[model samples]
Target: MKLYWSSRSPFVRKVMVFAHECGLAERIVCVRTVVAMTKPNVDLLPVNPTGKIPTLLLDDGSALYDSAVICEYLDSLHGGPRLFPESGPARWTALRRHALGNNLTDNLMLWRNETLRPQPQQSPEILAAFELKVRNAVAALEHEAAALAADPVSIGHVAIACALGYIDFRFAALDWRTGHDRIARWYETFARRPSMVLTAHVDQ
Candidate 1:
């Protein structure tokens, strides 16, 4: 399998973390690619109309898209403990947390993009809305921080970690750690995992 990869993409990092956790990392080859919101990757258009990185090209020539689908597909290939919990309350809880984390990530990315636009072109209303979403979501996560590390690893955990990581990388000025002591501690321990250490973001 070939993966359209990027060091700076949290979504791509999530897929790679899943692969490594499944012990299937060696079977795939990473093809570094870059894509931006306003600027599309023309070469990637034929394969994925969205021109998104983290697109997985399987051996049979089928392509999988976006982080959520790709992670679920990769989980199916592994027989060990699943990244997505199976049916039951555990499943719903994981899904709920994953939704929260993923949405937070989406808003963070949107906020970052808004901030990058030339001052005159940026929409203050849009930026404020996204920033509010991020703050509220992080507060919810901080409130439930104790439970975050209690269960076995799940895709939800992966999602949360990546969301937090992106904030650390791109919005250090936000100082998310303030007053979110429990989550801060939880993140410190979680970030030590081999997958995270290997995938840590470095500015390009």
Candidate 2:
């Protein structure tokens, strides 16, 4: 499999982290694909019209886009314990956590884009809203920190870790760890995992 990847994209890092956890990292060939909201990758449009990184190309000329979808596919290929729970309450909890984490990542990316604009073009209202939402999300994660630490690793954990990692990588000025000790502690350990250590973001 070939993955359209970017060292700077949190979503791509999420998929890469998931692949590593699934013990399928070696099977993937990471292609450095550059994409931006303002400038789409024309070459990537053939495979993924959205021109997103983390688009996986299968051996049979098929493709899968979206980190979550690609992660589900990777999970299917692994025979060990599943990151996505198969059924019942565990499944629901993991899915909910994944949604929370993934949405946080979305908000962070949007906030970043807004910040990247020229000062004259930037929207203070949008930036303030993103900041408030991020704070709320972090507070929610803090409440779930103990549960996250107790549960076996899941896609939810991966998503949350990636979101936090993105925050550290891009929004360090926010100093999110100041008051969120529990979640910060959880992430400190989670970030040490080989999957995360291997996929740490690079400005390039």
RMSD list, candidates in order: 1.0, 0.5
Task: Pick the lDDT winner.
Answer: 2
lDDT of each: 0.88, 0.96
TM-score of 2: 0.99
Model 2 lDDT per residue over 1-204, tens place: 999999999999999999999999999999999999999999999999788888999999999999999999999998999999999999999999999989999999999999999999999999999999999999999999999999999999999999999999999999999899999999999999999999999999
Work out how many backbone clashes candidate 1 has: 0
Worst 10 residues of 2 by lDDT: 45-54
Candidate 1, residue 202: the lDDT equals 68
After TM-score superposition, the amount by which residue 99's alpha carbon in candidate 1 deviates from its true location, in angstroms, is 1.3
Candidates' TM-scores? 0.97, 0.99
Q: What is the C-alpha lDDT profile of model 1 across 1-204, one tens digit per residue?
A: 999988898888888877888878888898988789999999888888899988999999989998899989989998899989989988988888888888888899889889999999999899889888888888898976888879888888888999999999999999999989999999999899988988888666
Q: In model 2, what is the error at residue 9, expressed in angstroms?
A: 0.6
